[model samples]
Target: MKLHPVLVLDRTYTPVSIFSHKKAFILDLLNKCEVLQYYKSIKLSSPTMDYPAPLVIRIPVLLRHWQSPTPTRRAVFIRDNFTCAYCGKIVKDNNATIDHVLPKSRGGTWSWTNLVTCCNECNQKKGNRLPEEAGMPLLYKPKRPSSFQIALNRWRNKINREFLEALSLYGIIVDKKKLPEGSR
Candidate 1:
């Protein structure tokens, strides 16, 4: 059977990676990590006690090699807050597209700095041309997102209020309004 994976954060509460339910439990049992949240509907049962399945856990040590996520279409949408970079219009996932600020013909590679979330209309309007040539200015400059930012965006749906509160305590503000309605 496929088990739901648990999110793992580092000692500083920066999201690091995902672990299997069994691994999470083993870490918790070994006192190597602490459970921050538990799955609401699942539990681990033993002869002597029952424990809620871990949904999120934090390790006691810092991560040495956290990697940033690749700039995929979904990640780009998340980074741009699902808003058209050219027109600043909020868009649903189906209506959003990735636009290369500098057209491929002009030597722009498919990198984070070149990609931006764009609406269908804006995309078509800027097709195969530089933003300047298309008379469209980007609303914000694109940059590579940190691993923590990517993790937060990628796993927002799986995270609960307590995790969000912890993020707030660390001064990380997730703009709920900017996220897609379906994502919450």
Candidate 2:
């Protein structure tokens, strides 16, 4: 099936979610969102299909970026998929601690860019030494994550199936795509 997808952007034009063409058209018709781009062709054959096919739409308002959550131990755990950056262990319980990629004593501050989820053994072994100094390499670099980033991951991994079914109930068909990845 030809799944015509539409990208939904915030009023600022930052992509926050994606919807099917039907949903996009509804948003346009309801004047709830503004069309930013149109698909190259008009494929809708219904008598009600008077509007252009939208490739991108912008919500009339923006969600709060100011109150987006700051990085915390739990947030870091969720961001990292609860996997250790050094040993790739899927840590459960309260056994995880946030480790500084660059040790704080030498320079690193407790920021997302500098911190990662690490287990007790690895944390103890690494100590205050840098990864290179201790001959331990990071599995992946850390990053500062936003609410959008976290939401996308949650949707992709857990909520997507339900979202698709729910959209189907509403007669919308969102084209599923791999979420854009970032360092974390």
**For each predicted model, how many residue pairs clash, with residues at least 3 apart or on different chains?**
0, 0
The number of the candidate with the highest TM-score is 1
Residue pairs clashing in model 1 are: none
Where does model 1 exceed 4 Å of error?
1-7, 11-13, 17-32, 36-56, 60-64, 157-160, 176-184
Q: Show the colliding residue pairs in model 2.
A: none
TM-score of each: 0.68, 0.56
lDDT of each: 0.79, 0.70
**Candidate 1: Cα lDDT at 119:** 93
lDDT of 1 at 96: 91
Backbone clashes in candidate 1 total: 0
Candidate 1 residue-wise lDDT, 1-184, digit = tens:
4455577888888777766678899999999899987877667889999888887799988886666678888889887767899999989988998888988888988999999999999999898998888999888999998766666665655555544555555566778764446535
Residue 181 error for model 2, in Å? 19
lDDT of 2 by residue, 1-184 (tens): 3445565677776666666778888888899999767765545556765556777678977867723658877878877877788988878847798999988887888788998999888899999998888888999899877665554444444333433443444344433643323211
